[model samples]
Target: MSELERRYHRLLRAYPAEYRRARGAEIVGTYLDLAGPERRWPSPADAADLLRGGLRQRLRAAGAADLIPGVRLAAVLAFFTATALAAVWSVLELHPPRAEWGVPNAGPFVSLGIGVWAAWLLAAVAHAVAPGRWTRRAVALALLSTVAVVPVAALAGLPRPPLFVLLPQVGLGLVALGLPDRLPASVRAAPLIAIAATGLASVNVLPRNDLFLSYYSWTASQILPGAAVVLLLVVLLLGAGLALRADHRGGWALLVLLTPVGLLFLRPLGGAVDGNMRGAPNPGWPVLAATAVVVCLAGPALLPLTIALRKRRRGPGPVASGDRCPTCGRTAERAP
Candidate 1:
């Protein structure tokens, strides 16, 4: 082989062995044809293209055969979200602005919380990078450990553990239980890095109270209505776009992302209504009403939009022919 051809073959190492075996020669031949005898090295563009294509193939292969795409997407998103939240919480617990909030000198409960987060983070990393039976086993063990420790800490008389403290851990455990034993490394890397970056940014930007306390509240006082409206609109638009693009799995993942936000409003709406009836100093009716409107509109609207888009994509009725329509199983003669 010429020097250029040799270098091209080395670059092909980016692709999986099976993919390379099937298409490597065809790709090499095309590159060689394009390069001609004069060229002695792979161009930067060629190297980049090969690398990108190889990474795409690797990710495509990472999907577990047993799980649907939606479930896999949800699992990855949940893991990343859980990891980020746990990291932030751990940081806050260790370094609270107030001495009362700081658990730096606490007993097993503090250790348990921090240790579980570390374990969960490691489990996610292992599942992403070394997906196998062993990885699944490790995840299962970590989840079990988390479950076991939480109640034990409570029984040991740690201050009434906050609802937020348990909720993320429990949610993550459930997601981990449902996830496939193996996942593609390529698919896992993006979410992992994104969560890490987000966690760091949030720790730096948000006040300790917002990170650790405000989320646990059931009132709208802590939430900004304008920001909430903007977020709701963004999520709705994103969901609509996903549906229109025929990305049902992605749409479902978006719903998973929105679930917590929806729940956040639910408690406050109820509290505000009850408080108003009793003449208490509640946040007021407008806050409750707006939350209700956003929650009601965002979820149900996506369904009809999705159905309409799908029907539109189906494109009128099946063509008239002697044979039956393969997809709808309706006879062609019966068509309008």
Candidate 2:
């Protein structure tokens, strides 16, 4: 190594000693390639900045970059903020969220805020406990869902969360259950399947005609639609919990797909009343309708965005390094 190379190696001492021991050559080699052969000695400040950037990148992967906590907090805030804001309208109008008006369901929306955040809480817990493919995907999905829910829910309210929430989870479950032996440690939560099953089973179990007639006014039962939504919420939590414990890949994936799909037919409007219907109860706000449209149409596309970001952060490893055999000591071992 020349004098410039020597100084660069010395500067690398600022990095973690063990990390330097393992990856020091590769990292320094990259910097050397960037700086080129005619390099001058790096100033103390330059050395410090390189070390800082490296450390920051590492921390972003391992530590504070866990966006779940922040997302959950935001969900919580959305819960209260939306509820409080809508409450003012309720007071002024002298009525709660009305199905006839086409507004979002206040109680369910607030309740769903809790449910959505709870699912995210489960995801964070899942990531903290396990860091495998399923757990990471679950965490990523929770974060993605959080980003999606904010504006969508702001418009849709709690009347019906989109069906996309837990639909993907069912696919995850099939995969998880298929390979019991190879299942990751985190996807072991036992209750997640039960929660999903309960959700799927309860879709139309609630006495629709009687209940719709009963609490259709004050309680807003008819507008609430199927129990699958609430069940999907539970599945989201339980699925995250399971993802943290056992392997249920296919099941979980399906569960994710189901969460949003369960609410497709559910419409808050009672009947037709567009521009000028004097008898029509102020046909709610279009936020609810617009939200439904967005969640249904936009949710699948949004999923890839989160997954892609994570993949970008975790770029492919060195060509040879990732191919090492776990069972054999031979670096050049053949695939099974």
What TM-score does each of the candidates earn?
0.48, 0.26
Please write out the lDDT profile of model 1 over residues 1-336, one tens digit for every residue.
Answer: 777889999999997787788889999999888885678889999999899677545433432111144445555555655565556545544432245566332443334466666676777677677765555676677677667766876776544324334443554455545455555667667546755775687567556453333323431233322223444564467557755744445554455445344533454554566576775555454655565566556754664465455546555433233332222223344434
Model 2 has an lDDT value of: 0.40
The parts of candidate 2 lying over 4 Å away from their true place are 1-229, 246-255, 258-288, 318-336
Pairs clashing within candidate 1: 62-184
Q: How far out, in Å, is residue 212 in model 1? A: 11
The local lDDT score (0 to 100) that residue 100 gets in candidate 1 is: 59
User: Which candidate gets the maximum lDDT versus the true structure?
Assistant: 1
Ten residues in a row with the worst lDDT in model 1? 59-68
Q: Provide the lDDT at 121 for model 1.
A: 71
Model 2 lDDT tens row, 1-336: 878778888877765455577788887777677775666887566688767655533433332222222222222222222222222212222223445655544443322434444544454345335535555465455545545655666676443233332222222222222221123343433334333443344333333321221123422323233333544454466446645643232232332343233332223322233224445542343634554555455645654455456547766432233232222212353344
